[model samples]
Target: MGWLAAGEGYEIALVDGKVAARSTSGRSAGKQLKTLPKALRDHPEVERLRRFADWLDRHAASCVAQVDAWMVSALPVPSAVLGEVWADEAWQAALRDLVVVGAVGEGPDATGFLRDVSEDGELRVVNLDGETVRMSAETVTFPHPVLLPDLAELRDFAVELGVAQKVEQIYRPTWDKPSDPNQRSSATSEFAGGRYPSRFALAARAESLGYRVSGGYAVHRIRSGGRMVEARVWIGEPHREDDSVTGGLSWSSGGRHLPLDKVDAVSWSEGMRMAAALYAGRTGER
Candidate 1:
């Protein structure tokens, strides 16, 4: 739903499962998500994804006039010593570039830069005390060495675009037990399956650009007729922000009809609270 809201679509449901466990072959440091499915890779959605990437590139070009260049060597076949190194003029130059990139369309200032030589690779820093670490080409799958400020610029740009355009969220739902019947004494008796109700909603205030949350309302039961999925939501009282009520806090029974494929997740009050908390933490304050 989030992706669709961003004016993009996904062919496959993104599963948050570990595709691979421990492996002798040195690759990623931690477990990674499964690879993209063929359907997703070849879907029309790729075009939309490319457009998103294009936005990043546009932001990058606008934010920074020039980016730093670094030389890197792979591990094991190393010919140089592996250890920390002191700051240098090259580091200062890189740091300046980052500052310029970070402050695009804003003010300008030079932070600090430092360099660190390590066994993994030659770590370059453009800011003081290694505030901004550099990733070389060899370290990342992508050809470019991702810069903190550059990535931040892209994010900022995306938010700006999203807000200005009023993007719609893409909905994708996957249920654990799609065919399971709802339990007795449940609120959703109208439907054949007494299945639990759930919703994966991505909504935010008009002021915000990007969707601030991945929310859901755990359904008591959802009935599928034709293309619509009637979702029965157990409403909680709206959330309170200071004196104002941001969302209703009533536990009243209500229902919403949405596309069958658009359901992102089952919304439970507890789960929604957690998700809201996470969003608040990321943005710093509600």
Candidate 2:
């Protein structure tokens, strides 16, 4: 952004997402100041720049959140939508380098890291073969890591290419369900018994990590295999000052508790992931 006259001899503009000032005269003429000048602190131009910077930060965060939701839900996004938003810097930052697959159709069905979206809604991607390919599919999906067939290989290749994604994808941790029916239980106690100073502390930690606090549990909802599943970890009562401990992790569908054996893979992994994250924040862990 170009500098705007702020006060008497200073001009202000956004530098690295912050309001910066420069003198238009004297020894410091045209030199970016290390700090905003006191006179320009309350200037209308400076205030407006600060407000704009704040909006940019919020817009970037919102973009990442939306992309994260799409990845978690494995929703199909239209190619036209991608092209429409690709011009926005914040949206491009969040969508670039994400792994995407063409929705089942006659168009290119291969999985690759998204690179570009043309004005005509064509997608350019770096395929597993280390080749750039164009996909003209009507829609594409940002598959969850749990559903990616070549997740491990993709991680290694991403490292080789020095891919730094704004949204967590290839490097996101995952868990697998036990295949043996004998080992299944309605809920797992692996992350249970984690102590917290107070119920509020545990619940606050859950909320800080983007989980919803409900009743006595921290819940993470996932849509998998066309079913809505909720993974919940017991975090004790709502009493703010009452000491609490974490409890077993479980999954439910349509208000009915599900056996670990019956929970779908994505649901099972997400539930365990939430339980483990909550446990990791407990007090005095050895």
Model number with the top TM-score: 2
Task: List, residue by residue over 100-119, the lDDT tens digit for candidate 1.
Answer: 11112322222222234454
For each candidate, how many residue pairs have backbone atoms clashing (under 3 Å)?
Answer: 29, 0
Tens-place lDDT per residue, model 2, 77-186, is 99999999999999999999999999676544368999999977899999988999988888888988988889999999999888999999888888877777655563
How many angstroms is residue 27 displaced in model 1 relative to the true structure, after the best TM-score fit? Answer: 24
lDDT of 1 at 78: 24
TM-scores for every predicted model = 0.17, 0.93
lDDT of 2: 0.88
Where in model 2 is the C-alpha error above 4 Å? 105-109
Candidate 1's displacement at residue 92, Å, is: 16
Task: Work out how many backbone clashes candidate 2 has.
Answer: 0
